[model samples]
Target: MSHLPTLNTDTIWAILNEEIDDKIVNQLVWHYLGYRYNESKQIWDTSAVAEEWREKYPEPPDFIANRPPTVQLTRSIPKENKQLLKEYLGFKGYKIGEFGPRQTRRATMANWLLSYLKEKQMLA
Candidate 1:
């Protein structure tokens, strides 16, 4: 059997929640959003749509792979994804106990959650 790194999701979550800075989150989020897996074209079947989005948004300085727009996971992320999600949402500076305030923008949270599951190796 291969020796894979076993990360403590809870520990990661705690660091992200009580310690991590917004800059890292922003960077990670940017990476996650602009990420394009090598198999994007073959898997996403969105050659046209991705092009459209690219045209709309200015090209990033770094080459974030041309991936499918939708956040799809092939395997499980770590549980930390969920904790990071909660922190991400909280970082948005939204008020709690409010009724669906303004617009619903939780893409970061969703993406983090997905990534967490994948990290945990639970999505397989």
Candidate 2:
């Protein structure tokens, strides 16, 4: 089983200060459930076309055989939330692009929310 990350508000400050990587921020704040980095569903074994290719060439070239698996994200935030967060980040003088993508924006929003809750003593 994959493990969920433990997160904290300092992660946000690190992102804002450019001390932390955007990928890390995304992983910590927005990775969808059951997602582990570089883990993805494979089509080579299931696709009819791929199976046909295997029958024609039993031994694939090294490049094809050793190709790294890629990950397809299930997505981080809902569309409605993305729009709201985009507008909010823009209002705060941030370029949404700076956050990396949907997942990164979700991280930023999460950091902001955590900070807010902390300030209000709502989080321990």
Candidate 3:
């Protein structure tokens, strides 16, 4: 049997409240708004759509953009993806409550929760 890593509340909380790297998030948001990476030029090619989105939200929200991050676990996300994650992990808990308003620690625990379970099992 393979050794399994310890699971703890802090680890879960860390994953749930994890904030994505700024550079990655920035790239994702820019790409979502129709910006492309110019490989040869080593730059991001911007478009009118990107400009408009930037103008509208100078700092785009992590959850609303939905780039597969921790914020999706929270109720703040209007997308159904959060529900799907919970269903996949069989998480049955309060849909919404007072998480103290930071938004990061309030999201669902499905992001890395599945990995922890998978590590402890051998699907056959």
Candidate 4:
């Protein structure tokens, strides 16, 4: 009854896929699995390796659980800004398709906008 939303393994995996480097994803997954396995064994030894793993892969924020279960961070963009961004990207010849498959265009745009906004200090 903690009232905190629970995040399952799949959700964690998806978030990790978006936010982390692919090279380290498998290592983190194996480390997490090992931690869970040791936890299940009930000996509960806090080994240095386990501590290191926790330091590297801290728990996701409680807010993440409350938000919609999507990799993209939710934010409202003004219609004018959206149009301006589209025009800007077009002018710069940065085609979304050039970056990746068609399905990923929205994610690509969201990430680009997030970076833009952060650089302008509009988002912290």
Best by lDDT: 3
Name the Cα RMSD for model 2. 12.2
Model 2 misses residue 43 by how many Å?
A: 10
Candidate 3 to truth, TM: 0.30
Superior by TM-score: candidate 3 or candidate 4: 3
Worst 10 residues of 2 by lDDT: 64-73
Can you write out model 3's per-residue Cα lDDT over 1-124, one digit (the tens) per residue?
Answer: 0122233433334334444433443344334345565678875455534444545444444543344434422433344344533555444543367343333333343333434344445211
Off by over 4 Å in 3: 1-20, 37-44, 48-79, 89-124
RMSD of 3: 10.5
Q: What is candidate 1's lDDT per residue for 47-104, written digit by digit as tens?
A: 3333444454333212123223222221223445644444543434334664231112
TM-score, one value per model: 0.31, 0.31, 0.30, 0.24
The CA lDDT of each predicted structure is 0.36, 0.38, 0.40, 0.34
Candidate 2, number of clashes: 0
Which candidate has the highest TM-score of all? 2
Winner on lDDT between 3 and 4 is 3
Q: Which of the predicted structures, 2 or 3, would earn the higher lDDT when compared with the native?
A: 3
lDDT of 4: 0.34
The window of 10 residues in a row where model 3 has the poorest summed lDDT is: 1-10
Q: Global CA lDDT of candidate 1, please?
A: 0.36
